[model samples]
Target: MRLSTNQVFNSHVSSYNKGYAELSKTHQQLTTGVRIQTPADDPVGSARLLQLEQQANLLGQYKANMTDATNSLTQEESILKSMINVAQRARDLAGHAGNGAYNDHNRQAIAAELKQIENELFGLMNSKNASGEYWFSGSQSGIQPYVRNADGTYSYQGDHSQQYLQVATGTQISISDNGFDAFESAKNVSRTETRLDTAGPNGQRLYLSQGTVATQRDFDGGFRAGAPYRLEISGDAATGNISYEVYDKNNVLVPAQDGGVGSYDPTLENPKISFLGVEFTLDAMLKDGESESDYATLLDGHSFEIGMAPDRFATVGSSASAQITDSTVVDADAYAAGFPAGGVTLTYDGAAYQAFAQPGNAPIPSTFDGVSNTLTVAGVEFSFSGAPVAGDQFSISADSQENQNILNTIAQLRQALEQPADGIEGGNLRIREAIATALGNIDSGMMQIESTQAHIGARLNSIDTLTLENESLSVYNASTQSLIRDTDIAEATSRLVLQQTKLEAAQAAFMRVSQLSLFDRM
Candidate 1:
């Protein structure tokens, strides 16, 4: 079979070209250090590599977020530590200012120092971060958190919304705390007062000791604001026996324990009365030359109110002027749980009174008794003394728990120290009370700051944990990606040498075959 010279030349050229192409491909793989340079080389492995790359990018972003969060939280913790030290100093000054031996000049010196501390605290509370954003400004990082008011009081302008940073997949951490919660919203020390609502015929006065809470949980659950318990006295002057009936804020009779009746023996010294987690002593201040027996008869219609002072109580509308006879809290738990933070408002439309929560004007379930002139709602009772016309409104506001800001506490202490106590009515007593309140409030503020610091610490720990996990995951991802996309250096190098040898043989054979042909054979 005769073969053409063109066919022999074409066959050798094709073999040489195929061998060179194989050798070039192996060399390219070795240079790039990747097994599959394009999707056509390994389609499934290329797709998997793309997924791993995207995951790695996401992990990198998460690490960046974690770092930022850590920095922000660390800054906050440092500021809070400084603020706590300032609060401790202020508390010490308050204790010193309360000394009765200290004269006006000494008090003035303390006041000056307190003013400086107040300013320092103010600056610390409004501290800025590395990015020039306020640390305690909630989500409004650009805005200042606390601002001084015209009346020397400090106001929190920032909102209560917290800022969060995503530290990992399906994980987020709070990076900022609001000023209101950290500085202005500490609980105040609980206290109660007793006042004579109605005097007896003989102008006799009922004396009551400061009411004290025996059980905090019970008190928080049972006590009511604006609602005072009523104490009525009834006795026979002849027998010199006095019996009392206690009524709660809801006007419901408080039954005696062990089925016993509430009785007061005037013969004994100042007797103690206990009810609803509160305990206080009761006594009578008689007129001149009057005996206990004579005062007992006059006390039949006398009544006294005992409860916490209301933050706000006012009657609105011009047509009808009604006085609040009694404002008492009966269900403290209900009020705390259901009452709006903004407060509540009651309006009378001539027939019945309607209760509405503040801010959004949401309706609250309330019942009004026309015969008793009482409105009961949110575990509190409001009693009116006069007739009301349509459009008459009554507003009663009291926080479920009282709070005083650290700045206000400092301002009050400074004012007390600066005021002259000489020859003023109850001036010394007022200063003492102010100092005591300041001390308590400062402690509360310190607690709040410490709590925030702890929360910041917790977030930092979480960031650390997430960082380690992210690192581990990154290592795993790198190993998997290497397996799928990286070249096996030893195997590729050997394959490249073999392809080179084969290409050399193909070239040599092609040269000899091209030279042969029919002319060489002749």
Candidate 2:
């Protein structure tokens, strides 16, 4: 409280320093466009700014993810579109080749074009992304999706699991689809069929029909359903001592129902070999050698596979037609002899169902289950259309999954076209069937490719939506951050002028007070 000149001068000096500091801070805020140059300038605002910056960074990252995902999806869609085009071309070729008038040379030429299309499709399926990773490889993007094996068949090496990118909060989008689902698993309609691959005794081979030899009933049986199994039948035709051996897909011998080597009883009316819910009767005819031992020896190592045969349905009647609806076997021999007007009845004797023909009952009325698309008569599934009063008849034959892929379809067509017309008993008929099946598979492949492309398009849409959302969020974050930490230029300029005036006044007062001190006046 003492009115000393020295004290007054020192107080003025302190006030001037404070005013100068305030002016400098205001100038810094106006020049830099930020209210808080350091945390001490505005601790709470600085904390808020830090939070807003973190949020903005997160949103930016989300936007980046969306961009990457969009790129991948777009690439996938383009590749799939190309593949669809290739498939469509192949389908057209198949359609042209299927014409009955086309000669073997014509078919072979078409097949050559189809082969090229197949290779192109294979390339598309193994397409790479911007990062050079396979687009359809699923989670294994680094590995190629498909590889050609030594046998000329393509194998899908990619896993089924899909990979996703986090494009938004709690949102993920798949960027790729598994090649298997896109290329291999596309089926328009699932039909049961068997294909025969007989080894040894060329002349003894049953002019094996071009349809399913076995149907898939229960996939959860002891034996694997999708995979192939070998059925080896060997024994003396004279003594009828034929025994059958069964092997699984891995070549491991599969035990019979009794867990022993499956035995075939010759005494049974139909000498059938049944395993894993599939049953097919052996041909009762003897070989050319004609000896019991020779028949047995020649039949040695004669093996055929039993598996889920597909695309092997045949309708035999011009009017009332029959198609296979279930996995049950239709004895081609029996159905042909007694079908249409023959009146076949299914006899279920508590344990199992059997097909029996009522001799007098011609044009038998089949019990049709429309829901399952099945008609049961004597343990065979015949899907019939239109009402058969008494004499209407039709029949379908065996089928399998062989030649299901585009490559295999083309291969079968080429083989059929290249083979001599008079080679086999039904050579022309078999070639016709092969061409028809190839065309059907190509159509199905086209459908699958289209579906996959549609899926990719949807993903691209989602990514665009996410990207817009991220941009909006980023803008919001920037505005909030500015509100918390950016300077108001008008307010800062006003404060700077005021602070400059205060500092000038304080300095003038300090100078006057210092002059008034006793030592200065002396």
Candidate 3:
């Protein structure tokens, strides 16, 4: 068909423009080194590339999380190692202190060193990470874990919650542990104590011997059940005869092994009193020229408690001045009757400190003697030295006679070393008992630290494993992404040359053909 001049020109121009466009695309691909410049270039490959890119970004984030987790766990492991070493040193000091040849002065020197060690342990327990967050504070990262209360007792202020980091799909690692489990929950070997209020009629002194667990199984059962026993003396010393009655926390009398009342002779030395798979002796501290009558009067009407100790106590409100002096669960039945499962909350209304059961906020029968600064409630007697304002609160709860903190153990040992012995024999006995208890608790604390270290080591191992897995997946993703999104350098270069030649040929042909048009030829 014969074409008009304008139609022929339009056709040649269109051909040239198409060739140039192809050439320009090839050159852009070569320059950018990407096959799919837009989704229109290769729809399927572009979509796949997008997915691969997302996976690569996710892998990078996982890698970063693994790094942070590793660093945190490493710091914890190192701190725990240091704590173990310090505990070991303290144990050695305690073992040495138990030597019979060591005098009160020598024991005091050992205790001073122990106090330094205790300070070291305290710092370690409250250690902070590079971000200034407490390592053992669990989810409460910003709060300090261990704090010394005003009553000279150490308490764990952190909750038992753990923090985790996601390192991979379906894989989360714990990055922190609560301080309560690690530092504050050592097993208490000495679970019995003479009542702090036990005194003679004239306020003469008497101390109970450190009790022994005669039967492990029986004691363990009772301790786990929170079974508390009380011993009361009734007979007089005039006839050189003294009888004692054992009662459960409910105030019911317990029969002796021979199905009779237990008797003790004050004239005899260190008479052993046995009950509930445990045995201890009542030692009367007879003063110079003091008679047995005074000892009998001291022993009468006073009670000793077994298998009970304070577990956890805290004072609330900024102005609460009621420091807990004695929180031992003296009367278990009374404690259970007054305090509920959530413990008791004592609030001072300026006139008296009212007791209320926790969680439910039920009021409990309680009395606070303002003159003596003592609050008696739920079979627990709390002595305070400072005046408390209205709305001041205090909370205390007892454990199942199971655990004590490492700091308290060390503190007790230190106190024993510092205090003057009741007498030569009494002082030695007290020091020996303190040393034994300290050694047992320190060992228990060390074991707990080691367990935490092991857990950290396990988490680190998991991180290493996950890291390797993530790296492998990342490599695979990179390879797939390169195949789908990266340009073939050699192929793009050859295509660019061919497209350039085509564009030039199209322009040459179009120019020649346009010249041959009828108008141009005429």
Candidate 4:
């Protein structure tokens, strides 16, 4: 088709402009080494490159997390070793206290040392890692695990939540032990006194059984002498110097105040009875079987025995010869296991008990079902043997594993040598064993930490390897993208030179063509 003059000129101009534009773009790429300067340059290549950059950033973050986990685990392991040392020290102190040759003064000095140990242990329990996190407070990384009260007894501030280290893929390791399981709760016993009026004018007397003088109680709801307590009993001087008694916790008689009678009086000078309603076992008493009621002849038979409260667990005696059956009575652990949710309705057979909790419905029951018979309470766990009854009640208060059994023999020997009574023979064997168990736990914890370290190290190593491989892959991918979308510097330079020559020729031709009017030619 024949074209108009304007159309022909515009077409030639478009061709030259297209050639110059391509040449300009090539020159710019040669000036800048990078293939893609912005998204507009090559949309697909730029997106892929951005993705590679994000992956690199993510790899860096993973490395940082690995470092934090490793450091925290290391701190936990160090603390466990320190705890092992403390257990050995405690065994030594117990041995010193047990020495028969030691008098009260000497014992007091030993006790002071024991006190120091307690404080140190408290400090250890409250130990903070480099991150200002608590050592044994479980998941409560910010709070101290134990608090000292004015009453010399320590209160546990930590629960059973075990903190864990996230060192690897799908693997978590416990870094802390609950403090409650480490220390034993002491049993508190006390006494109170009140006048016993003869039951219904029948001259009622408390029934006494043989070898029962050590029973502790609060008489007529008079007063309780348990933990963090003091004894204060009031009496009338009129009842002809009323007879009373005193005792201690655990049904053991306090030697200083045995068969205690008040030495104070309401009106009578120095006529005070310090011991009123003292807990005593119903030992042998003058017998009348059953009695008759006559004020004159009624007081004649005068058979009496001490009454006991149900709350006060009774043991026959502390004598090792008293048979192991009575052992459960003073054993706080046994009571804790056997007692109900409110209080233990101990078996009359006097056998040790294992309390359990009832299964809840659906998910709750499934948690402890036979197929999945694991009870995980903050990582502290126990398995139930049989299905729980409706009223089944597991103990919330139970002796925790102290892990002292892992102590080295050499450390134990040192303790035995320094304080002879702490050795593992004869009556003191139990105490020694307890300390050993704690040490054993330390060993176990250390092994766990070391194992975790290995895992974390492996994971970190993997991260590094994978991250490096990914980096290499990213480089290769980038090179391929550059090939598809990048300008060739050598080819671009050659085109730029050729385009400049053509552009100058086109300019001359255009100038010549514009001057080609008929008048100009004439």
Candidate 5:
């Protein structure tokens, strides 16, 4: 193969240009601190840099989320801390009121203060976030979660769903929980039977119309004095009537039995009167006499025997005890007489359970606190079901992970506090219970918020590390691109000079060779 001077010069020029370009490019990278000026300079590196940039952007977003989480935790913690203080104040008030030295006026004063605390707590429960959303309103953050009704009861308007915050990849943290979980569900309320009979209760009785006036007597008149005897009533005429009233252990009439005011009947046949649990018929008293006994058949023609009147657990309180209410008063004597001893058995209201006892002699309620379900009399606990009560008072604290944190406990406390001490031994203890429960919840929620903040901080740290790493990778990627495609001005200039000299030299050489050989031979 023949080699031409032009070809040699062309090859050296190209080499020179590339060398100088490489050096200049290295200098430019050192000056600019970035290697990539364009994607064509390093295609693969450019692609990697793009990826790194996207990762960095996402990392920044993660950091922002972490910041938001931190702020939320801080806010929650502050609220919970304030709540703790309020609870403490409430507890102190309850303690002061519990002292036997305090009068109703003192109690009312404490209650007034407590009411203020409650109003403050209500505000806390319905607090809003920076976004104008109610913090404890669950999924209904835009609305006021609680409202005081005309009857002084609270009504919840928020939904029973959680509000979620995306804190990490595929991990959503719930920022709010339904009010029902924390407050609405917890209530210690006095419950009463919806079903009451018109007749006497507990099933005890025996009476019938005798001669002129009905006389209550033993089954045979001459019976063992030890056991209660049964008595019967019989009416001589078909139109004859008889009636009696059932009384409580206190001998108070709970229900009236004046079928008619005053009516005369000699031997009212089967003048039956239902008292206590048993039905007394006069026919039995004159069964042997029949027509002579002035006893005609009654609607049932059955004989009524009156013994210890079965067990007509008569009403103790006023007409109010039949319905559920915090203010319904239980008759002291009637309540006591109805009980095996003189107290009420409790049912769970989903929060704390409470017991009501017959009125005890107004000695001071105990000053000490304990947790036992039964009220002790002479060191013996009367039977009542549910959580133990230490003293007259007991707490049913809320344990919800959502809402105002004190909702359930607060409801329980309020209901118990409003109750009277008559049918409940140591009723004051219940007020204390409510305060204690609210305090416990406040403290717990505060700790939880702090813990959440710490965890969010850790996440922020991870985000920062990721962002820094992405930044470093981006720089390296840019430098690699500079190596692949930057121009070297010094090398390019040197190649131009060499190429010019080579062209002149090649022209001279060709001219000399042609003149010496070709001309002579021709």
Candidate 6:
């Protein structure tokens, strides 16, 4: 076949160019230590390498997330530890302040220290991270978690959205918790109050150690819960005498013995003034040189108010005994259980009497047996030895629990300290109540803090596990990428030499072939 010199020359040039290109590529692979410099080098292997590199980058990001999450969790854990210590210290202080011997001045000093602790705790709850974001503010890291109100109380300002960080594919970890659950919104016990009317005599107040005040009475003459009662004492100057009557919140008269008129005995010692369902001893009676006439004048128009007390709790079992005229045994517990929510009235009508749970519930009847002197009604047994008065009556009622919290407990302690147990005007009672409330609140706060700490620990452990998984995945991805895209040094060097030799041979052949042309021979 006849070939043109131009075509022959073009063929030799093409061969040399191809050989030089291969040699350059091998040289590049050897120098850079990468098997493929571009997609054109090895399309399938290059594409696989790209995928492996992306996987490795994602693993690196997961590791970074683990680091960030761990940092946040560590900060939160440290803050919580400090909070627990603070709560414990507060509890210890409350225990010390509760001592009855501590006078008002001493209590005030304790309160000052507690105020500092409260402020400290508030600061801790509103702590920020290295990034200047709140640690307990949930998703609203920019917002403060707790705010102090003008009334000296605290309110949670943050929402309950837990902040999270993605530590892995399909795995997210909580980086923060809200303040409401950790501090402000902890569960507290219930609290109630038994207060006196402001309009009544200032110093002529009454306190009961065992019995709860009935708050309500049914229209059918039965007891009702949440009923407010007051003992009204009225006096006539002409008679030089005073009488007591019990009235409900609505001023309705409550029945008592012999037309509900309190049997007012003027005897100074063992003077029993009985009315409604309760009896009070004149333990701290009138001041020195005070006569019955003087007593009547002093309490002329005043009333003794009674309601729920803070320390009292609602219960299924409570007992009360009346001053029996004879050898009478009363089963107060069984009788009280069958009574209404507030209380009930047991009236003796000479031989037999009736008991009412509520106005419309039912009337339980009891007949006095002179032989056994026993009367049974509603699982209750009342045994009397002598003949009982026809007008005698008894009152029994239920109770409720008080709701409690840390702040209120602290406030109550401060109040108690301000009014130390002086030997006058119920100072002892106030101090005692203050100490009890403070101790309870401190315990509650500690419990809540511990619970939150437990959650923080679990989250930290999760971060650790995720971090390990991320590191392991990163190593595997790197190894796989190396196998797919890394240069085999020995193989690349061998290919480099072979390509160079071929390129030199092609040049040599082209020189000889060009010389063989007829023009060259001539």
Taken over the whole model, the C-alpha lDDT of each candidate is 0.76, 0.62, 0.75, 0.43, 0.45, 0.62
Candidates in order: C-alpha RMSD to true structure: 8.6, 21.2, 6.5, 21.0, 23.1, 19.3
lDDT of 2 by residue, 1-522 (tens): 668766776777687777778888898898889888999988888888888888887788888888888777777787777877777777777678667677767777876786777678777878887678887787999999776642344556677888898888899898789877777675522233344566546444322222222333343355345357666766665775667777777887776552326665534443455555444445433445564445454555466666544323333333333322334546645544545443344432222323444454334444556565456653456553333334434333332343244555555556566666543455555665565556666777777778888888888887877788888888888888888888999888888888888787777766775776566668
Between prediction 5 and prediction 6, the one with superior TM-score is 6
Tens digits of lDDT, candidate 4, 376-416: 32222334344333333332322222122222222233333
Over 1-522, each residue of candidate 1 has an lDDT whose tens digit, in order, gives 877877887777787788887888889999999889889989999999999999999999999999989888887888889998888999999989877689889999999999999999999989998789898888998999887743466767678999998888889899989998897677665356777777777664555554655555656766553247787777677876778777878887776861114877655653666666666566565556877667668666677887785443323323356656666777768766786666678887878888988878889998888899898888888887777777877655553336667887898789878999765644554566567667777888888888888888888988999999999999999999999999899999999999988888778877776776466668
Return the TM-score for candidate 4, rounded to 2 decimals: 0.44
Better-scoring candidate (lDDT), 1 or 2? 1
Off by over 4 Å in 5: 1-27, 175-522
Question: For candidate 6, what is the lDDT?
Answer: 0.62
**Candidate 5 lDDT tens digits, 1-522:** 975667766765675576566656655654565667668767886787677666556655655665666567567657755766776676566556556555445556666776787789789768888889987667878989876532344556677787655644566555554555545543221110111122122121222321111222421232212223222222335554543333333334433342211222434433444332222222222223344323233312232222221111212221211212222223335333433343333322334333444344222121112353333322223233334323323211111122333433444445545555433332433344344444444444444444544554565565456556645655675565455545455664565566556555656764674355445878
Q: Taking the tens digit of each residue's C-alpha lDDT, what string does model 3 give over 366-421?
A: 87888888888778777776767888877665544467778878887888887776
Best by TM-score: 3
Q: Tell me how far the alpha carbon of residue 405 in candidate 1 is from the true structure, in angstroms, after superposition.
A: 2.3
Model 6 error, position 187 (Å): 2.2
Candidate 6 residue lDDT tens string, 126-178: 89887899987878889887665323445455777898877889988888778
* Model 1 vs truth, CA RMSD: 8.6
| Rank by lDDT (best first) | 1, 3, 2, 6, 5, 4
Clashing pairs in 1: 224-329, 226-327, 226-328, 227-327, 227-328, 227-329, 228-328
Whole-model alpha-carbon lDDT for candidate 4: 0.43
Which residue ranges in model 2 land beyond 4 Å of their true spot? 1-9, 188-190, 194-405, 517-522
Lowest summed lDDT across 10 adjacent residues in model 3 is found at 309-318
**What shift in Å separates residue 291 of candidate 5 from its native position after superposition?**
50
